[model samples]
Target: MSTPRDLMIVALDVAPSRPLGRGDLSLALAGAEAYDLLRTGTVRLRGDRLAPLTGPGPDRLAPLPPPGPEDGLLAEAAAALVREEPYEPLPDWLWRRGRGLSSAYLAALEAEGQVTWERSRWLPFRGGRTVLSDTEARRRAAYRWAADEPVLLALAAAVGIREELTPADPAVTDDTALTVLAAVHDAVMELEAVRQRRALEAAAFANVWRGA
Candidate 1:
């Protein structure tokens, strides 16, 4: 029902040709969370920085309202908001909130019965694969994916799925949503760069050892 959950279901249901990296998916899920919170007026972007919406107060900056009870992970995310001046930048928020987010969502889905593990018919003793259950949540996510909803499509593209709507498509018109998508893209690329740098370092170390 939530954007992050819907994106996770879409990823599993679509099963893209190239496997998605968990890190990349986690970053996009964080972006999806930001998008949903923005849609609900829980947060807002001030020129690429994220700030939680506060209620009226004498100081003009009250505490953030609580997240809905149904989404515990989102509650945690809301609590993690940087509620001071010089609020956290969008890309930094994505990297911070996205840590291990994919695993958290997967565990939540499994516990909620939204996903189930099914063993292969031919290999009874082997490990089973988790699949989405036939539920309204899955159906709604599928419909959104089929419709190429801009937010979902942009998140999917950040995770390297090229089959759906491109991020450049004019479907997403909201300036705030577009900002979230751009931050997600930048974060993913930064993560990829880190991975490449680490790989190169490892290769150089191995070469030095071999020469010695």
Candidate 2:
């Protein structure tokens, strides 16, 4: 049987088999806590499994809000696990349209020596000549968003519970825990879909904008 964490990692496209960073570890723990809580029944997982848990549907015209501070921290952690940097400080327009953390943050982290950005460059890896395809860039962004979603969800739920996020909820049970996990699964899927759609749109727009 696949554990909740395993399902989440796959859904978020995170390679859980690799080592993790502090923030990534924290997020993973938080996800585990949420799973436990749901399993124990401390918090009830309500609403339709397929319904939007916290954001608008994928087909909507309005964009979702960019990730907040918690998201940034979690994303940083996840990227570190992959030996990459977390993207950040996205453009205002994209943020308003619900773009998550900016890829710039990861670049900034790499420059700061907080984490390594893995990829083959034109020059030596250390010579700063790494080459990255648009698809690779999009995948990185998706992973960051996926890893951060659980953390954000737990934090938001914690606000109502008046407690810190944890792996075990005093009030959740196995059945309900699965429901909550499903909610998380839904959120990750939505985020990934949005990221891919935006990337495609951006690529097309770039081509048109450049008269290519």
Candidate 3:
């Protein structure tokens, strides 16, 4: 029952039974979309050396070049992602990744029954809101990965959510599975440090203008 969005949702709701505030939803969605794009070859990440995986023929290490100008959120974020210094952490560089992607994966996650939204008691329309959700599936996956459960272990390894990263419990293990968890954590931290960071918000509003 777990979907790609759950990867981000688990990071947002570590506890199995609490509601998550909507303020961070934009950042969470960005992380989810980043993971999907990365997993599907829409983007690529190089270890340590950190050069973007995009270039000419043999030079084109990325599965696909970043999306174009009219392609929307993933494109915008990919454009920003390659600009960071090679020495910077991938998570840190992704603060601006996928600029207007906060809502794309959410509907899918909700449709899958992993989360539920309840209208705000006060400002039902634009005010702050939170959604109820759980992390059972992700937690279980993490636990299996830690225990070196064969199938999950291979999957995690193939994806770089290395076994050495997990502990004995069904825990986050530095939030590695989908890569989005760590990125979301960093993005939120970055957003907090610099409150003026409104690119995501601006892009979000712009979508409304385009009738998206």
Candidate 4:
């Protein structure tokens, strides 16, 4: 049988924005469930913290101001977040444009009911042509984190299940293994709920903007 890692390797090779096909969705959901088990398992894997997945330190995970000229690096960073290789260093104007595009994409996702938006304010700081406050960066991170929940859950579940099942035959089962699988399933479901909500919100928002 193919292991979770093998499945995930295939998934990651695909583009992030690729719409989830039925098979893809099934695998992703299963993977998310398996991940929860791994985290709570006895093996105690290292580097499971939310900080590394999200960004810098926990404290830095706050809302940040809009990007400025100096913050052009953010565009590259954002592209990286989506796992897209940066093409060229974005110019100040292009960086701003990219930021706007990223925000719009998030907002669209929210309107479509794939995610939710929580409002917060931040103090502004200078960058290039625009000013970015620390608060805005934090806010962006929060949104990004939320958006990434589904993928993360999938990854975790896949790893967890793989670790548990690799040593035994496909038919083997113990109470501990069963419990871990259940937890993984539960986590994936929660993430799916969030994604659905964001998608709905994004659709609604787009409708309003389009005046339809």
lDDT of 2 by residue, 1-105 (tens): 112222232323333333322233222334443443333332223332233666532221111223312333333332222111222211111223222222333
Which regions of candidate 3 are displaced past 4 Å?
1-3, 7-23, 47-61, 65-93, 97-100, 107-182, 195-212
Per-residue C-alpha lDDT of model 4 across residues 94-142, encoded as one tens digit per residue: 2222233324333433444434433334523433221222343334433
- Cα lDDT computed for each candidate against the true fold: 0.80, 0.36, 0.46, 0.34
Candidate 3 clash pair list:
53-62, 77-98
Clashing pairs in 1: none
**Candidate 1: Cα lDDT at 105:** 93
What lDDT, from 0 to 1, does candidate 2 have?
A: 0.36
lDDT of 4: 0.34
Per-residue CA lDDT of model 1 for 1-212, tens digit only, reads 58999999988887675668999999999999888777776776664223336532111111246553257777777777788775677778898889999999999999999998899899888998888999998999989888878889888977876554554573888977887887888888899999999999999999999999
Instruction: Order candidates by lDDT, high to low.
Output: 1, 3, 2, 4
- Model 4 misses residue 58 by how many Å? 24
TM-score of each: 0.83, 0.30, 0.38, 0.27
* Backbone N/Cα/C clashes per model: 0, 26, 2, 48
- Scored against the true structure, residue 29 in model 2 reaches a CA lDDT of 34
Worst 10 residues of 4 by lDDT: 57-66
Off by over 4 Å in 4: 1-172
Q: Give the poorly placed runs of model 1, Cα more than 4 Å off.
A: 48-70, 119-127, 164-170
lDDT of 2 at 107: 48
